[model samples]
Target: MYEIELLINGRPFRGAAEARTTLADFLRHTLRLTGTHLGCEHGVCGACTVLVDGVSARSCLMLAVQADGAIVETVEGLAEHDGTLHPLQQAFRDAHGLQCGFCTPGMLMTLVELLRETPHPSEDEVRDAISGNICRCTGYQSIVDATLAVAGAAGTEGSEP
Candidate 1:
């Protein structure tokens, strides 16, 4: 087993897991951070997306040991201290961007990275950014709309997260 220490959602975690254990496994099985879903274990699907050092990554693609010294932000970390939803979360709700909600966590994480990298993204840009993520529910347009709403520029003015 390999020992790893990481800062996850603002908390420090230290544990011993198999060196080959996926970050997804460590998060969900060990830490119970179920918000990081496992869509396609091969990383084709972005369902396991999370913020690794502020960039969106498929947690399933990396071994838990690889996350040593990394800082991760999962969907569960996005809420306000008072339990209020972040603007993006509320926007998704208002725009009806989810169906079964399985993909919502990944979508939110991806959007957070998108907004951080480009506070204001064009529709095409949004689509391009999320191309790796697949939503079988196919609520894509509304997801885009909701993302735009969070950026506070649904009309192409570009918004930031």
Candidate 2:
């Protein structure tokens, strides 16, 4: 067993994890943070995406020990302590960006990084950023629209044809 320390959703978490434990397993089974879903464990599907050190990463592709001392953000971290939804979350709801909800968390986490890197990302850019995630429902247009809605509301919407 290896000792691991990580800051998740602004809270410091320390625990013993096996060397082979995937971050997704660590988060879900060990920490009980079930927001990070596991779809394709091979990292092909972005369902296991999370923000590690502020970049979108496939949690299933990373070992728990690899996240020692790293700052990780899960979907649980996107909302305010008082329960107010993040703008992106709200936009997703308003735009019907999710249907089955399996892919929402990963998409949200991925777009969080994208919006931070490019505050005014174009529609195509939003699509590109979320290309790694697969949502069997919603057909993706609503997700793109939701992202654009947040960008426009933030006054940082970029023009893309």
Candidate 3:
């Protein structure tokens, strides 16, 4: 087993994992951070999206050992400890961007990175950003609207955990 150490949700974590262990498994099973879902283990689906070192990445596509010394952020880290939602999350809720919720986590994380890079992304850009993530429920216009709403609102893209 390879020894790994990383910062997750602003907290340090140390653990041992097999080389083949997916980062998603390490977060969900080892650290008990279940916000990163595993919809498609093949990585086609973005259900396992998370921020690694400030960039959105597919947790299932990365090995746990590859995350050693990296800073990881999951959906759980997006809100304040007092339960205040991140602006993106709030937008999602207000715009009804989520339906079944299976893909919400991934959508949130992906948009988080997108907003960081492009604070005021256009509708086409929003759609491009979420192309990798599939939501079987909503028509996706709501999700785009939600992202645009957040982009248009008071900036909360840089909220700290």
Clashes of each: 3, 0, 0
Error of 1 at 76 (Å): 0.8
After superposing candidate 3 on the true structure, give the runs of residues whose Cα lies further than 4 Å from its correct spot: 155-161
lDDT of 3 by residue, 24-101 (tens): 999999888898899989888899999999999999999999999999999999999999999889989999999999
Worst lDDT window (10 residues) for model 1? 152-161
Clashing residue pairs for model 3: none
Winning candidate number (lDDT): 2
Report the Cα lDDT for candidate 1.
Answer: 0.88
lDDT of 1 at 60: 93
Between prediction 1 and prediction 2, the one with superior lDDT is: 2
Query: Which pairs, if any, clash in model 1?
Result: 119-159, 151-159, 151-160
Per-residue CA lDDT of candidate 2, range 65-154, in tens? 999999999999999999999999999999999999999999999999998888878988998999999999999999999998888878
Residue ranges of candidate 1 with Cα displaced over 4 Å: 153-160
